[model samples]
Target: MTPQPFVAMKNIEKSFNGVPVLKSVTLEVEEGEIHALLGENGAGKSTLMNILGGVHQPDNGTILINGEEAKMADPRVSQEHGISFIHQELNMVSDLKVYENMFLGSELRNKFGFLAVEEMCRQTHEILAELGVNINPKEYVRNLATSYKQLIEISKALLHKSRLIIMDEPTTSLAEHEVNRLFELMKNLKKTGVSIIYISHKLKEIQAVCDRYTVLRDGQLVKTGMVENEDLETITKMMVGKAISQERFMHEHPFGETAMEVSGLTSTGHFKDIDFTVRKGEIVGFTGLAGDGRTELFESLFGFRKKYAGEVKINGQVVKIDHPRKALQAGIGYVPKDRKENAIIKDLSVIHNMSLSSMGNFERSGFIQDKKEREKFDVYKKALNIKVHNPRITIDKLSGGNQQKVIIAKWLEAETDILIFDNPTQGIDVGAKQEIYQQIIALSRLGKAIIILSSEAPEVLRICHTINVMYHGEITARFTGEGASEEEIMHYATGSKREGIAIG
Candidate 1:
């Protein structure tokens, strides 16, 4: 008898707006196997996962469970098939308690037919305990840290009796220790025969947790085989169909006076006594595994955090920036991590959004707009290769990568001396990542002081003039050219006690 695979999909075909997303892509996941799905952004990796999770129905495909055909008409239907998905965007009610959030749809009913609060809390605690997750199930999700929220989302999959778990960029927002805990849990679950399909851009993660992999390129199958002996170079080659190089890194020009300075930068519990300096023309990359207060640090620096207590200095002049508007007026440009939330305006015209920050420069007599505004917009639009129907069209219509370029364009128009890029390449395609990387170095070459907060290790190594490692609101270690070691950095990042790590 032929032993059936635990899950299989044959000849999957899907498209969006007549563009082929998945073309004749077939995948199989044996029982208890961790299948690593690989692809550049928009290479049909997301589409395939979406179909499996009932988020989208394939135009043509056959899904089989234990060799028997199955129907996945909707997310609920997919859930019924014992498939639970943890998306990069955690969908949890912030106001609700963890226990209530866990028992959300299936609240335990007491004998009187009321909500069984005690029973639900007991079950949530049991689930958390079994997974070795140290969390109070009754605490409000908003009160818990972002890492704890991530664990809750993953645990929800287990509570649903899901045999096939699909995690998409699960650690994109987790701290170092939290990521290790998550990885350990993944191994434990796999030992118990639960299949995990992890999708991410972190190559090291795939190499560590995945035993087998399937590579996708331009909406087609490039390779599918066991991950054993499959190095990052090989996986990358299949995904991009080319060699990945570090040619974008350039020599640092002589830094001038301090372009920006922060003295005793603190935001209560988030970050404290954060002293840093960015010299003119220097690209200082502030890096840590996500949730190391990198984002919060920048937010405070840009005056987005009201409770922040810090002194900002530009060109050796101390200034108080009490709001984002004040920060922009002080010649500071900040490009946020979440493109949708912080950068682009969906309904606005591309030209309009690009010129928004510098609108006053484009206005005359406090009423009339000038052609110079459009010329400014076209300069960045063409330089960044922003794809759109027209400059007058909406900004949100572009792809993920294109949208990010628009965000940068908005800040570039402001002509700020100090640029704050918080995970600028997060969720963008590989090709787009390369493009943005080149732009970062370009900005530095133009004598713009750039500060980058990134989770991807390769990105920091490739562009930063110097690197600083942060842990629990403290600068743990600093690395200079040729001295930056990934292993040593990870050791301090993951809370190791050993010392002797160097600082640039």
Candidate 2:
């Protein structure tokens, strides 16, 4: 006879503002198993997880823990029931120390009701050691790297003695080695009978770590089965309801004269002697591991870093870009890496955010042309397939993928000849990524010089015409993207190998 599931969510249904987001979805998690929840953006994955974590209530559903009906009225009750959630944006106070964050709300006290610092540090050290993390328990969280911060989150979950943990995009900020370490720790946790609900867009990682998988599409469960029995393509098809092509997505386009050229672009300790050129109708990609300075280099190029020393030429004419305004005037547009923090204004309406940079063109006799602005936005909305009920609402209410599309629409309306996209598809879903890629290709075809900066080598290989690898602020290798290998790129990115180039 088969054993009962450790946790089961049956016939879950949720609606937002009278619009159904989840429809009769069911999920089951067995003890000591790593189960993956797979889906594209806006497919009801977050809503379902929120219901399990007690952040929201399902309109129609039943939750059972070990065949016993469970009521998750609040987060405290869920925690008491041995459930923990580690969100993508980690929930840790940066000002607090490591041990302080671990025992933030649930503190230890002595018989006299005094704070117990020694006991808390001891427990924190024990948990960190178990996870192969060696650091001072008193270290400030703000000073630590992203991977260490992620480790601290996992340690906190373990400290709660949680039987089940829900990890959302846990490896988004981790490096390759750090991801491997996390997978190892997950295996150890599984052996100890801790169930994990893994959610990520990286299908390769899902296949590597998860034992069982469930795919959700358009608020409905499409399929659930063992990961070992299905291929990545099959799983992707189930999620998006179509087969996605893996070949290069760039279409035939004629390359034009150079649009932007940089020489001796040095930011002193960040990057050194960076030399590259992007031509109109060309797509160039810069890729490296963490701390390789790819993002820093692009930030400087876009005039966000004023201390950088570089000779920049736009359309074969030398220009000085000391501020973002200057970069815009020079016909260079940049889509920053972090959309929520860097690109989107939380309080601004979606239409206003799209027309923010181009407001001058939308002004008529000292009056803003709201209708004209929205008419332009409607064109992009249709072309990009952006889903939004009301354009007057705040941009933050949309999904990450849609928010990114709005940002892209903003830059496209600016009509810049040189465009730089840093981590173009950083937090986006699989289907949205392909759409963005197609948009980039379309921009290139329209005689725009496109530059893509990403850490994922596969992303660059699939869409870029030229790929440059950087290590320690230096360009280590350059591939034509005709037949570039991730292994070769990683070797240079990790500083294991370098190609000597003469500095001018």
Strongest candidate by lDDT? 2
Best by TM-score: 2
lDDT of each: 0.78, 0.86
Q: Locate the minimum summed-lDDT window of 10 residues in model 1.
A: 495-504
Q: By TM-score, how accurate is candidate 2?
A: 0.91
Residue 253 displacement (Å), model 2: 2.5
The sequence of per-residue lDDT tens digits that candidate 2 reaches over residues 54-146 is 989999999999999998998888898899988766677999999999999999999999989999999999988876789899999989976
TM-score of each: 0.85, 0.91
Candidate 1 deviates by what RMSD? 3.9
- Report the number of backbone clashes for model 1: 0
